[model samples]
Target chain A: MRRAAVSTLLWAYAAVALLPLLIMVWNSFRTDQELVVEPLGLPHSPSLDAYREAWVEASFSTYFLNSVLVTTLSVLLSTAVSLLAAYALARSRSRLMAVIEQVFVSGLMMPVFLMIVPIFYLLDTIGLASTRTGLILVYSAVSIPFSVFVLATFLRQLPVDLEDAARIDGAGPLRTFWSVLLPLVRPAVATVVVFRFVPIWNDFFYPLILVRDRARYTLPVGLTTFFGEYQTSWSTLFAGLVIATLPLVVLFLVATRQIVAGLTAGMGR
Target chain B: MNRRRTAALPTPVALLFLLPAAALFAVFVLYPMATALTYSLFSWRGTAQDAFVGPANFVALFTTEPYATQLPRAFGHNALLFAGAMVVQNSVGLLLAYALHHRGRLRRLFQVLYTMPYLVSPLVVGYLWSLLLSPLFGPVNAALRAVGLDAVARPWLGDPDTALWVVVLVTAWQWVGFPLLVYGAALGALDPAIEEAAMLDGASSRQRFWHVTLPLLMPVIGTVSVLTFIFSMEAFPIPYALGGSSGSPAGATDVMSLLFYRTAFHSGASNAIGISSAVAIVLFVVIVGISVLFTQWFRRVERRLT
Candidate 1:
């Protein structure tokens, strides 16, 4: 009886969690008139009209490309820089290194809102404002604190025998990090990538504020504008949402275990 | 544990490794934050810095007409969001985690299902909920009317009184997966022997959970609280997506970030930069200050546990 109750509860909660997205995806294939007539009914006849409209007419293609560029570039840039910084912090024992680590760690608490206004001006001053390059830089910089924290913690906990072996093999520091230690910390790197990728991909704030040109707008911004413009066209909006969300959903489906491991690592301790 | 291995990487090489991150952080993050601080002190005339106001903007923020009222009201909404999330979201997460911990069947699938919404953008989540709760043709109202509960069907997002709470519920719906995953992991890592011993001592399952399990999970609880608090205070996308930048329905769902956005960008006020910078500074201090307090308290709790 208890087991039955538990299973039922879990299944119910699961439905609550997933039914909205399922409904949204389901209804995207239906026309807006069908939706207004029967909000809960299955699509009478599935069509790709909504998808085509969102993609071709609404310019989701451009937003999708911009999102891909910005998210990939920022994630790669931040992860690389954070890896080096994490390695330095992990391998060093000096007071200066400790202070530097603290500086980076303190950034983990720095609110983006606090820096956004100033960042706008600063980027404008440097002539990078409203540019993808500027948004990428901001994304990379904001991501540093958490990425470094996670990577450094992971690196510190690693066994030192690998580094020692590399040293005896006549490998210098860079070589050891690149060839020896880097391979071992692939999971940690993956963790950082997974965590950072979601936020940068999903972020609406920075893109909304930083980028002005419609051509350069990311998906989140584009989706909002699309919704505003097509307020009466529910199916098209749903299609746009599916387009915006499908990549992350696919990513989650593929990397569920890695993402959970990344989130839960060092969590309980 | 080898000191020699630690010392092998010379300081210069270590510094070299750190330089890129340091430079990016300094220029982009640190410099911008410092500039925000400086910007708060000056009056602005349409993006150009005017005479140094020296806290005059802050004075207007706390003492003037619209801001004076809006600041407290928005902060209150944030507080309500934090409290609501704690009560509704985290507790549900804890219960769900406990169940999933005890019942292992389809656990991996459940984890994925629960966390999927969290992985998506808050803007998307907000929009999704808005559609679900739309009174005109939303399925929720449709189902209600179908079931003969037509009176219960109303414009959820359009009502001022219910708007903020709806945002909170939607937020909880989106993020409950986070605490579930965190707490599930924590529960998994727990040593079963202690609970077993407590059971042997004539403790009920409830007693064992309260006395043995709850105390042990306090630190993780604290960490989750701090994160929830920070996120709640910094909430923007949900309210923005749901209520628009003005946090409409007569500003019922207005939040600090939205207020700041309007002040800085949309309001076209003379001192938009200065006043908005002050708002940002206040938000920064509130988040950082309360987080520090929570962290200190969590350390105390951990120390006591040990």
Candidate 2:
């Protein structure tokens, strides 16, 4: 009886967690009229009207592609730069190295809001404002603190003998980083990739402020536009929400272990 | 001699490795911060510096009508959101962690499901909830109607009294997974023999939990609280999406971050980069203050535990 009670509670919590998403997917398939008339009922016809409307009329495809480009480029750039810095800090025993590590760790405390005003001014002055390239650079910059923090922490725990052996074998510092150390720290890289990619893909603030043109708006900003345009069209709006959420959900489902492991890597410590 | 011998790479080589990250950090973060400080001292319209305002913007932020009034109100909303998330989200997360810690088979599945929402954009989460709670066609109201609770199903996001609370609930719902996973891992690593000892001592389950398990979990709890507090202070997208950029419904769900963004960038409002910078500074101070306090307290608890 006690075991059954615990199981029931677990399942109850699961239901609460999943019910909204289930409702979202279900409503995405129905017409807006059907949604209003039968909000809780499953669609009788199961048409894809909402999805079709959102994709074609709402310009979700454009927004989707913009997000893909930004997220991909930013993650790649952030991971590479962070790995280099982490490799340097992790392997070196100099006081300067220690100080640099502390600096990056302290960078974690600096709020993004504090930088937003100045970043806008700086970007505008440099003629990079409202461009996808500009947003990509901003994303990469913002990701550095956490990326370095995670990568450095992971690297510190790794054995240094391999790098030393590579050096003894006449491998150059650059070569060792590329052919030796980088491959060994693939798990940490995966962690950084998963952690950075989701936020960049889901980012709204930078895109909202940086991208003035409607053509350059990322997914979150584009969704805001959709929300404004389709205020009363409930099913269509639901379909847009599902489309915005589906890629991340699919990515999370595929890389669930790595994502969770990356996110919670140091929490238990 | 020992340091030189043990060094893994040459100084120049190490510096070479660090250049890209350092340059990016300097250009984006450090440089911008310096400019934000300078900009806060001047009355700037967009990119043009009009005049040196010195501390007038900060003064107006503290003493004036809307800025002064709304800033505190927004902070109050942040406090309430922080408290609600701690009480509702973390508590449920704690319960879930306790339930799932020993159940090896289903833990991964539940963890992934609970955490999936966190990966989705907050914009999506906000819109998703708004749709879910739409009075005319939402499933929440439908369920309420089905169960004969029609009167209780009001316009959740439209009413000022309930709008802030709805944002709080939405944030908690999305974030509960973080604490669950953290606490679950902590719980799993706990030695089973300690719990057995408490059981053998004739302690009731409640006593065992409070006297044994709870004390052991204090350090993790402290870390989670600090994280939740920081996230709460920076919360924007949910309130922005649900309450509109104006934090409508009579500014019911206005938060510091949202207020800053609106004051600085909203085309409808007069651009007050100076005042907005002051708001950003205040927000920064509050976050740093809370983080220091939490870190000190956490250290104390960890010291006691050790």
Candidate 3:
């Protein structure tokens, strides 16, 4: 009886947890009138009209493309740069490297709130503001600390013999890092990519502040404007929200173990 | 192992490898932090500082009208959210972790389901809850009324009294999955031999958990606490989405991050940049203070446990 009660509780919470998503998927096909009249019921006749409308009318395509471009570039650049730095930090036997690694790790605690104003100014001064390149640079920069943390730790655990072998073969520092350490830390690279992708895609604050053009708005920021403009259209707004969220959800579903492991990897042994 | 062979790679090579990350960090993170500090010290109109404010911006946060009135109230809301997360979210996650710790297949299944919402964008979560809590068509109100408790059904995100709490619950709901997984992993990693020893000592289940399992999980708990506090301090999306950027429904849901965002970008108030920078500094100090405190606490606990 006790075991049954415990299982029941777990199952109940699981149901609660999944309910909103199920509702979202369900209501995206629903009309606003249907939603108001029978909010608890599944859609009697599901339609893709909301998705179509949100796509064409709400300009999610522009926002979607911008997000993809920014996230892909940012993650790729950040992870690659971090791999080099992580290689140096992990393989080196110097106090300076140790201190640099510590500084990078400590960067994890620095909130974007403190840096947003200055970053805006800095980008504006460099004439990169309101451009995808500017946003990409900002994303990559912000992501460096955490990626370096993960990558450095992963690289540190790897046996030093491979790099030694590469060195004996007369490989340069860049060659040794690329050929030896990079392949070995592929798992951490994937982890960093997945970890960084979600936030950059979902980020609203920077986009809201940095991007002056509506054409440059990422999905989250665009979706907020959509929410504000179409406040009354529940169905379309749900569609937009669903569209905005679907990529990360799909990524999480496909890479559940990696995402979970990557995130919790820092919780200590 | 030739020390001289490894040394041949040289400092320049390492420095070359460090250049890109160093450049990016220097430009974006370090410089910006220094800029925020400097900007906080001056009275600025738009992008240009006109006079040396000398801590006046920070002082004005307390002495002024909208800021002074809103700052404490916002902090109160943040404290309430923090408390709710610690007490409620942590407890739920802990209980779930304990119940599912040994369930194998069921545990993995629950882990996936519980963490599903967390992976969804916070903006989406905010929209979902606001829709779910809408008085007219939301399922929450519908379900409440259907169950014959119409009196308690509310415009959860629309009322001043209930808006902050609703946002708190949404924030907790989105994040509780994190601690659940962390605790589950920690519990799974506990030594089976220790658990067996505890059982063989004639300890009841409760005693076994409290005396053995709980003590061992202190490090993870501490880590999760600090993480929770930092994330909560920087929390912006959910409240911004549900309550609007002004932390609306009468600023009941206003947080420091939201306040800073508005002051700097949206407010258009005079010297808003300086004041907002001051707010950012406060947030930074709070986060750093909490992280250091928690790390020290975790070390002490680990030392005691050993």
- Which TM-score values does chain B get in all models? 0.95, 0.93, 0.94
Question: What ranges in model 2 sit over 4 Å off?
Answer: B1-7, B267-271, B301-306
Candidate 1 lDDT: 0.90
lDDT of 1 by residue, B1-306 (tens): 564554357888999999999999999999987877898999999888999979899999999978999999999999988998898655778888988998777898899899888888999999988888887679999999999999998999999988999988888788788888999999999999998899889999788877888888888888889989999999999999889998889999999999999999999898899999899999989998999998998899789886
- For each candidate, the DockQ is 0.71, 0.66, 0.65
- List native contact recovery per candidate, as a fraction of 1: 0.75, 0.68, 0.66
Cα lDDT, all candidates: 0.90, 0.85, 0.85
Clashing pairs in 3: none
lDDT of 2 by residue, A199-258 (tens): 888888888888899999888999998998899988888898888888887788778889
Q: Estimated TM-score per prediction?
A: 0.96, 0.96, 0.96
lDDT of 1 by residue, A1-269 (tens): 28888888899999999999899899899998899889899987899999999999999999999999999999999999999999999998777999999999999878687788888888899999899999999999999999999999999888888888888889899999999889989988888998999999999999899999999999999988998999988899889999999889878877888899887877887
Range of the 10 consecutive residues with the lowest summed lDDT in candidate 3 chain B: B1-10
Those runs of model 1 whose alpha carbons end farther than 4 Å from true positions after fitting are B1-3, B297-306
The alpha-carbon lDDT assigned to residue B242 of candidate 2 equals: 88
lDDT of 3 by residue, B1-306 (tens): 543335234667777888999999888888887777788899987788889969999999889888898878777778777877888666888888888986766677799899987888888899888888888789999999999999999888879999988988888988898888888888877889999998898988889888898888888898888878888888888988888888988898899888888888888887889899888888788778878987997898789887
Clashing pairs in 2: none
